[model samples]
Target: MQSYVNVRHSAQGHPSGVSVLCVSSELCNRLGACHITMCGTGMQRCTLNVTLEQAMILSRNHGLMPRCIMQTMDIMRKQGPRVELSAKNLKVMDQMTPAFPRLFKLCLPPSDGDL
Candidate 1:
């Protein structure tokens, strides 16, 4: 858990990198924020600060979530908002599972290094 939070936004900078879509923190919701950095070169380093409500929107609409936040959201949905989730307590949910199919597939760098 701390490992993910301590993650830097970038290791090697990339021209086209990870993008953190903006969420409404002021007007819409302001519960919490998640800062995540993807691990790769030629990629963007970003920290997304968003409310819990906004996180749900991203997962529902765009299927995007910072790793830890996603698990937190799952706990919130299942256990209700009053409960808090610890990394040790919250079991990470699989997005691709039959009950929760992913709408988008991750596009990774080529294995052969053709790019």
Candidate 2:
């Protein structure tokens, strides 16, 4: 099992992030689903039954940038499975690491309230 957090930061460094849990091919076969948590102004969680390769391909073809795909894979390889990306956990992480590089390129513009 492997996972990575794809974080985006506003110009003022506010985090608007999405966390992805990348399941390896073997693990995907065994577990049959991967948990995904998306965080920004709010959070949503879902389960998807897809292997790492399938995920990469789908993301690439469906508008995810190339750099994001590469970085996500790299993080997954290095980090293994450590953090569970629930909303509370992500908020804790946001507090701990406020300066992570803007990993997500396709970010929506922050609303006036976010500023």
Candidate 3:
């Protein structure tokens, strides 16, 4: 999932330009990893184990921008269930907000197919 946050101006009304946040995953030989890329003011890239929660937290602390982080989390919260259920025998055990880091739980689907 990817989200972009455009900052047109700073508090002083100076042009600050735009920034982009991209989140993607790779699976190779049953080893999966997640990567985050930030581009605009500067560029940064990092790879980590496939724990999106941790990745988001790290990104938030890394100064990628809050709007970008929230947008990415919203996309994941909306699409996560479908992605989880597409597997042959997988189930969603719990739904938690990655942005707030366990502060809230999302309502679960009534059935796997219902999502």
Candidate 4:
């Protein structure tokens, strides 16, 4: 079996706390997780595979706008080919990227003739 390290926030309190998990592709499928990979500084690759329900909870709990969430997910997915975002999702992602740089790292330029 493939091995991976997962990070989780302490279950005490802090409602807005963040929990991160890192898992390999094989382990991800074995655990029935939907994974999203992100590229960090220094070319480090990070994988996030929080459950869909947990993501929805984070969205609602943190009062995050839908567009912002999509953009953040887009930025994360851009690191690898494992995840696919829909066209409508791309639209929302485009709208949020420029406006919320603090929430996501959108270093990529607009695609094709989006200029």
Candidate 5:
């Protein structure tokens, strides 16, 4: 028996698909180790090709400006992260906020309390 791994892609820089091959022992011996065969039908991966105009309309429906989206994506690529607060800190703050109502209430002065 013979097995082969194939890397496939379209000439336009898109995914073509993935395929597997299995051969009989006799054919494998005849073909030797290196064998090339055309990929069978239904090998291409499913894809959706949308034009720029259609994409823009879709973006509009989603309330996104194409230019702003592009800029935001670029900024994301440059920045390590968008939010500074750590998840631990956020969780701690959430827990403490409910547990210490008096601490938060201290921000407002009591009418009869000492200055």
Candidate 6:
């Protein structure tokens, strides 16, 4: 039923719709573990294809961006995350404003400039 639904939705003009693949165990054995490179990690991973804005949003939402740019350099390098950033995203990252690190549970007072 879900397959039928997917087909129907796909047929209805959603070209970028998510795709699903199901294969028999026999086929899986035959295919084996073919070399497949993956981007992202765990829940912080990005989609197979993503835009620059999307990438920035994902990284920020995942708390990958650092509040302190200089300090986070080591952390970002050590993690070695492969984010396919666009030119725009790169520019924004370069001029990033000071803010709390992503995913930090501790409360931070709002920036002094803001009321």
Residue pairs with backbone overlap in model 4: none
Best by lDDT: 2
TM value for model 3: 0.22
Candidate 2 C-alpha lDDT tens digits along 1-115: 1233355577899864333343344344467664333345222222222224544654645765545665655555445433344434567545544443364323545778888
Query: TM-score of each candidate?
Result: 0.20, 0.21, 0.22, 0.21, 0.18, 0.19
List residue ranges in candidate 1 displaced over 4 A.
1-22, 26-51, 54-66, 81-115
Model 3 lDDT per residue over 1-115, tens place: 2343334578999854323222233222125553333333211111112224444555645665645655654565556543453332233455442252231223222577666
| Model 3: colliding residue pairs | none
Stretches of candidate 6 off by over 4 Å are 1-17, 21-32, 35-90, 94-115
TM-score, structure 6 vs. true:
0.19
- Per-residue lDDT tens digits for candidate 5, residues 1-115, read 0112233568998744432322222244356653333222211211111122223334445665555543443344345222222333467434423343453355445677664
Ranking by lDDT: 2, 4, 3, 1, 5, 6
The RMSD of every model to the true structure, in order and in angstroms, is 12.4, 15.4, 16.6, 16.6, 25.7, 20.4
Pairwise lDDT winner, candidates 3 and 4: 4
Ranking by TM-score: 3, 4, 2, 1, 6, 5
- 4 or 5: which has the higher lDDT? 4
lDDT of each: 0.38, 0.44, 0.39, 0.41, 0.35, 0.34
How many angstroms is residue 115 displaced in model 5 relative to the true structure, after the best TM-score fit? Answer: 71
- Tens digit of lDDT per residue, candidate 1, span 13-73? 5423212223333223355554333343311121122234445566545766556555654
The candidate that achieves the highest TM-score relative to the unseen native structure: 3
